[model samples]
Target: MILKTKITLALALMVSPVMSSFATTFTKEFERSDGIHKVKIDIYEESNADTKNSKITASEYVKDKKVWSLVDYVNKCPLDINMALIKDSFEIKKINGSFDAVLFSYTIGCVGGLDPVTVKYFAYENGMKHSLRGEERMVTPDGVIDDNVKPVPDANLKNNVLLFKYMTSNWNKASTVILE
Candidate 1:
């Protein structure tokens, strides 16, 4: 019995490292200015007792030197931002002449009995970040003309624009924003 127990303990120790290696993590890289400037997004899943949570971090490197990070930008937000609620999932909508447009969606707490998912548009250009505002729509549409439509990134530098669709406070209308 003593020998058997020792063998079982040894096997468990050997398998522990192999199992932990399967933890979820994802990374993506983008480059501009002929690969002189680079941006990397790293997503890491957190192990928690009650809920599954993940963090998305972005870093910018210029010629192998770290320049900026997403954390820095979030810290400067005007409101008391909850970094934990920011989803790990993000879309790199477009890479324009010297900018990369990114979309991050997060759920805002109930305000006036309405909880809305706000989609924010940000652009990284010339080693700086800028927020792109949605153009005011003249008339509100009746219903969702389309659902879950993915925007295609334009490769032409001349057409330096980022286009994406997002949901508004009302479920009936979906709005599209163009960032240039």
Candidate 2:
């Protein structure tokens, strides 16, 4: 029994690092520029041996400086680290006359097809960052229901406010929400 235990421990130590790397894989990186600011985006895929599902993460940087690291944001938001933002799903737009007042929008892909897509907005005003509110609506074959479902799709900026429009599951109806 002692010999068996020693062998098990030895094997576990050897496999742990390899398993960890497999659990979270760094996939790719891309860059986006809006004339003034340059954003670098990185994509990662996280999985677990205990579960069959995996999640994707998007990390953003500006001018080679980290602006919104998904890992850090997830930790601060207390969101599931595995629920990652989709790649190339972010946009930065000027909100008002002041360039400092900018709006950032991104989307998080769900694990299943039926799961509602999550779109998040961030406001940068006077060098401060704030998370705007979110809204959702349900779509049905018969009609659109304002079942308090958070809207999906990308976010748009109008008069310094963030807005989103999403269609129901069946694409039969559409709804819009203003995030303040």
Best candidate per lDDT, number? 1
lDDT tens digits, residue span 119-172, model 1: 333444454554432321213244332235332322331133333222222112
TM-score of 2: 0.41
The per-model lDDT (C-alpha) reads 0.40, 0.39
In the predicted model 2, the residue pairs found to clash are 135-150, 135-151, 136-149, 136-150, 136-151, 137-149, 139-168
Looking at candidate 1, the ten consecutive residues that score lowest on lDDT are: 108-117
Candidate 1: where is the Cα deviation over 4 Å?
2-35, 72-116, 132-180
Which pairs of residues have clashing backbones in candidate 1? none
lDDT of 2: 0.39
Which ranges in model 2 have alpha carbons more than 4 Å from their true place? 1-36, 52-89, 100-113, 125-127, 135-142, 149-180
**lDDT tens digits, residues 5-67, model 2?**
999999998777432322333333333343233433343434334332333333444555655
Model 1: lDDT to the true structure: 0.40
